[model samples]
Target: MTAQAARHHAEGRLAEAVTAYTDALRLDRRNPALLSGFGLVLRDLGQIDGAATCFEAAFALDPGCVDAADSLGTLRAGQGRFAEAEACHRAALVHCADRAPFWNNLANALSRQGRAAAALAAWRRAVLLDPALPEALSNLGGGLCDAERLDEAERTHRRALRLMPDEPQANNNFGHALQARLRHAEAARWFRRALALDPGYAAALCNLGLAVQRLGDGTLAERLYGRALRATPDLPLARFNRGLLRLERGDLAEGWAGYGWRFASGQAGGTRPPRLPAWRGEDLAGKRLLVWGEQGVGDTILFSSLCGEAIARARSVVIETDRRLVPLFARSFPAALVRPHGPGAAAVPDCDLHTPIGSLARVFRRDLSAFPGPAGGWLVPDPARVALWRERVATLGPGLRVGIGWRSALVTESRRAAYSRLDQWGALFAVPGVVFVTLQHGACEAERVAAEDLFGVAIHRWDDLDLTDDFDGTAALMANLDLVIAPATAVGELAAALGVPVWRFGGRDWTQLGTAVRPWFPAQRLFQPQGGEDTPGVLRRMAGQLDSRLI
Candidate 1:
């Protein structure tokens, strides 16, 4: 009967195998191998609790039972108990050190626990044990992509596809490697192939949507995202992608809800958010609120617009922000205690409630009506420093002081298409009676030199003011500028927040929230690309405006 049950299990007859195993187990209840065999059949039949019980019984009878340990570990992983899964896999490996699949399973559990480097090492060990292992190769490819070793990932994924030709997950993972390399069209083809293999594959659907979105079909992208969510309603990547699309398309109510999935999608960075009692727009009449900054420096500034509103409701407010912005925030919100924040900022004591700065938007800026603010700006610069900067700029001769930033310092391949060369802005640089000054915060000396050498036009910047570290000084300097022209970078955000007339170009970000004008900044003059218009082309149009209006 045991032999017949093993044969049935091997032949994929799970129902018959279960019945045979039951009969065999009645005679030999303490047999570890029989119990493990029954567990495998129960697992195949989707009776997870029954399988776990059988496996636990088998392992208890014989701790060296490899099959029982491995099966239980896999089941734990399926249940999202990754740490316990890791321990089980480790125990199996101790007795069966040569098993490649055991290493692969262990790698998966490590990866889920956010130990990327350790997972990659484990996957490498699995591949070393059995080079033909398709799953390990596929997972290794993903790890390489995460580490930004694109060339290695591309090669690894191609090999994985060769081994797993009809596997949807392998194909989808390969497409991710291609997508990371900026090969969107090719990635879309692989994603389509994955969908062909498994039409209801939610991951492939979401990946295809992203690839098509990059190809400039927002409508198709949105439809694909919807389809993916319909297949798996809790798909994080789909929800996050759909949220960005909805925000850009002007659908706020659903957009913010979807955007909240960013933390799960790994787009917002960090493995864990600050551990504290989350503030959900509660009445804080006598409560202290601790709001920590997330995202970039510019984002902190943009969201700081709501600090005053938060302070009005709370008895006391604690604004934890980038160290550079500490002085500026302290001066602006004198009523609040502003502190310099780093990692593990949630340990602040005496706070009644906590919230990430970005979450403030869902409550305050639920509609377009919440965007408009004060005349001067939400952030107030030091009066003495502003007057000093005004005097310094007055020495440069009589003309409008215009601050310009051509591009972001941290431009990756995905962002390269949106940015233009600094020389492409010669038309704006040539605008008569405007003193072009560099508002770029980092590594602009090289670009400024090259631009001056190429066009005989200099974009002047003061040496004393460290734009990167001295936010107070940068704020004061920006307050003196007549207008600021830049891409959608931190410079543009700062200038706009300071209430200077800022022309922000090359923007297709979700932060626009579907407004022609920046509802966040009353002084912003948008120069976003019109249909088929590149940023350089948009800058040329701004040049024309510069001559016609400002000049």
Candidate 2:
């Protein structure tokens, strides 16, 4: 009977194996080996609880049954009980320390518990025991990448590929390593290869879309995302990428729906634990609502525009925002309670409902026509700080007072191309009556020196102000400027929020939606490069516009 059951399992007839195993177990109920075999067949049939019982009985009957312990560990790991899984794996290893599969299973449990170092060690041991284990090699490569050891990760992934050339996951992971190094074209080829091996590979398809997007081919990227979605409709990555693409093309309805997938896709940063129910455009007439910030500082500023609408609907609103913006938000929305994110967040009064700041767009600005027009500015800078900067600007000899920020905090190749080089701003610097004030934050001393030498203009710098940490001070300085020219960084968003005249530069980013102007900021004008034109051409066009306005 056991031989027949084993033959059925080997032939992939799981139901027949389960039936045969049950008959054998009934005949010899005390046999630990029979119970362990039955447990494995039950597990394959997805009867987790039944399988667990059989494994437990087998272990109790004979504690030396390493297979039973290993099987139990795998079952517990699948159930998200990592501690129990670890104990089972440890017990199994005591009996068979050299078993590569047991070590790999232990590594999986450790990885799930966020013990990266321990997981990596176990994976190394497993690979050392069985050098031909492709899965262990692939996992080890991923762990190396997580630790930022890119060179080792690349080599390990290549080794895995050499062992199993058609392994979909190994190919996908190798592409990810290349993508991290910004080698998008090479990464795209690997992703294509993965798709060739497994046509319905959703993750590979989505990654291919991202690579194509970085290559400045949004159209192809959109099609690739579509293919991914067709393969796996519930894939969050494909949905999220498709959403951004649709929004960039001005398809608001579908775009906003896709945008809702951000939280599930792990793209949103600083997400708080879900304590209160999410508001789905429901009535908040008498409810205390919490609108917490998600994503970057720039997104917080841009989306804060919708607070007024929420304030009008809700009885009382509590806004949880970045600490730097707390004072600004408190003053801006006097009717609501503004609290800084982290530590003291729990001290705030409980709310009837909560919503993410970005989610407000889904409710209020679903259509382009639904967007609010210039309500002057929602954020108000300190009048005292404004006056201080106003007096300081008098030392610059009284020109047009144009503030310039030529870089974003993100220094990726695509972002750099969108922002342009400091030397490319020569045309704008040559404008007759313009004096450039440096609003750029971070390490820009070298860029500033190069720009001054290359463009023959003094780009003024203020060492006293910490632009990165002191956004309040930055806003005050921006309020006193005649105009600010920047990329789609937080600087542009901040200046526009303060009602400063901002000429913002960007490529085909979703935020602007390929429009001449964005509905979120009336004080800003969008400057896009002409067909096949580089940053120099865009700057020249901006210089012409500045010349017309100043003259």
lDDT by residue (33-105, candidate 1, tens digit) is 9999999999998999999999989988998898799889999999989998999899999889999999999
Query: Which candidate leads in TM-score?
Result: 1
Per-residue alpha-carbon lDDT of candidate 2 for residues 1-551, written as tens digits (9 for 90 to 100) = 98898889888899999899889988899889888888888898899999999998998899899999999999999897999999999899998899998898999899877789999999999999999899999988988876667899899999999999999999999998888777899999999999999999999999999999889898999989999989999899889988988888788888988898997675786777447888999889899999999899989999999999999999999999889898888888999999987757845557888899999998898778887677667799988998999899888897799888988866753345667778878889889988899899888889999989887899997889988888888889999899999988888888888888899886757876546668788657888877888888888999999999987
| Candidate 1: regions farther than 4 A off | 1-125, 181-183, 214-217, 342-344, 391-398, 462-464
The TM-score that candidate 1 achieves is 0.85
Query: What's the CA RMSD of model 2 in angstroms?
Result: 4.1
- Give the residue spans of candidate 2 off by over 4 A: 1-7, 20-40, 48-132, 139-155, 176-189, 209-227, 343-349, 413-416, 421-432, 449-457
- In candidate 1, position 503 carries an lDDT of 84
lDDT of 2 at 304: 96
- The C-alpha lDDT values of all candidates are 0.87, 0.88
